[model samples]
Structures are given as structure tokens and as C-alpha cells.
Target: MARPAVRRGAALGLGMLWWWAVLRLAFAPGAGVLEAAVAAGGWGLSVLPVHCVPRAQAAGAVGPERWRGAWRAVRTTTASPLRRSDAGSGPW
Candidate 1:
């Protein structure tokens, strides 16, 4: 189904919510970082308005090749296996 309109509406609602958050913080003194974050998250959740936003499926079934490729990339950048000599290398 075409969802351009739905996406646009959601974006507009989010923008309005962000504006509201700014206004709220401006008017309410002593509203700290945590309070602002909660206000923004709550507003974002309300803007969705749908019971369930359907997730787009993967292109197709995942296969062993995908798994192997993922593992290879992960192994390349990560630290190598720790030998016995390195037992106390890290901070306690």
C-alpha cells in the first residue's frame, strides 16, 4: 500500500510535538534533562495514533551466507580471543 500520506502526517505531528516540548520547557522552570526527555518520548508515542505500526519484512528469508558475512565483519573489528597471559589485563 502507498504510505506517503501517512508518513507525511506522522512527520507533521512529530514536528508539532517537538515545538510543544520546547514551549513546555520554556514555560516550566526547573524542568531538568530527564523530564524533557520523558516529555518528548511521550509526545512522540502519542503522535503515532495507530494501534500497531506494521514492520516491513526483510527482503527474503535469512540464509547461512548472511550469518557468515555478519560473523566475519564482527570478528574483523573486535578484539582477538584473550589468552591466559591476558587474564588480568582489564580493570577489575
Candidate 2:
């Protein structure tokens, strides 16, 4: 648990560093709004894989049962009210 948490923290730290770099590059003198927007978008897309590493680590650490339970909770929280009503409960 601690190990995965540490890894997740490290990944998040790295992601923040990546964001810092993107912001620096995006805001550098002579950078246009379109150019900065493109740079930020590209950086966000690239960092997505890094974000997934933490989730993967956490799921692996928790094992299937607990991960499933967590996933259920997430689904319940995110599900549309109409969908929940149609199902008569949260998604399994």
C-alpha cells in the first residue's frame, strides 16, 4: 500500500513538473495564443499515460476484489440519475 502510494505520489510529482515545463514553454516570449494552446493540449495528452501509471499501481496493489469495489463506487458516483433509476441500483 505504501509502496504504491509512494509511486503514485512520485508520478504525480513528475506530472506537475511536466506541467510546469509546458507552462514555461507555452508562455515563453513570442509564443502566440494558438501556439500556447497547442503546446498545452499536447502536453496534457502526453501526460495522460503518466497519470495512468498511478491508477494501475493502485489497482494492482489493491487486488481484484477491492479494485472492483472501488470501481463500483466510482460508477455509482458518476452514473446518471436516469441510468441509476433504469438499473434500479448502481451498476454492478
**lDDT score of model 1?**
0.71
Question: Once all C-alphas are superposed, what RMSD does model 2 give against the true structure?
Answer: 13.5
For all predicted structures, in order, the TM-scores are: 0.34, 0.32
Model 2 steric clash total: 0
Instruction: Write candidate 1's Cα lDDT for 1-92 as tens digits.
Output: 45998889988887776667777788878667865885778677768857543334435556778889988877454668756765777654
Which run of 10 residues does model 2 get worst, by summed lDDT?
A: 75-84
lDDT of 2: 0.67
lDDT of 2 at 11: 74
Q: Write the per-residue lDDT of candidate 2 for residues 1-92, one digit (tens) a residue.
A: 79999999987976776666567666677655665565576677776765455555676466678978987777435654456446666556
